[model samples]
Target: MSAIDDLADQLARDALDAAARLGDDRLIDDISKAIGASSPVSQEAFVSAVRIRQALARGRAVMDSRLTQAASQKAGPEKSGG
Candidate 1:
């Protein structure tokens, strides 16, 4: 990747990590806005990377949830004393 592309990717990753740590999901958007104001050239790439990562995270969560539910079902229901 070119320098700008590499930088954008790193910024996207760092922004996501920061957001997770700070418990503010808007951090990505805030970073994107800052980049747009200062370095418009890399803003698109950064935002794209952020979106791709978020989508991947969501997909993984869905897969994990489905597998967990399936396993619980296969294990059968719990029993209780009368």
Candidate 2:
């Protein structure tokens, strides 16, 4: 990857972390706007990285919830002895 791509990914990751840490996802959009102002190319790459990462995070959460629920389910009664 080019230096800009790496930098964009890093910036996107940091934005995600900060937004989550502050409990304000809107920060992602706000940061994106700022990035666009400085460098549209970087902003595009950064937005794409942010979106892909965000989707991954959501997918993981969904699968994790299902796995936890499945694991915690109670087993049915055993067959009775004759």
Highest TM-score against the true fold, candidate:
2
lDDT of 2 by residue, 1-82 (tens): 8999898899889988999899997998998899899899988999999988989999999999998887767454567899
Lowest lDDT 10-residue stretch of candidate 2 = 70-79
Q: How close is candidate 1 to the true structure, as a TM-score?
A: 0.77
Stretches of candidate 1 exceeding 4 Å from the true structure: 77-82
Clashing pairs in 2: none
Best by lDDT: 1
Candidate 2 wrong stretches, greater than 4 Å: 74-82
Instruction: Give the TM-score of each candidate.
Output: 0.77, 0.79
* Candidate 1 lDDT, 17-65, residue by residue in tens: 9999999988888888988998788899999888888899999999999
Per-candidate Cα RMSD to the true structure, in Å, reads 3.6, 2.5
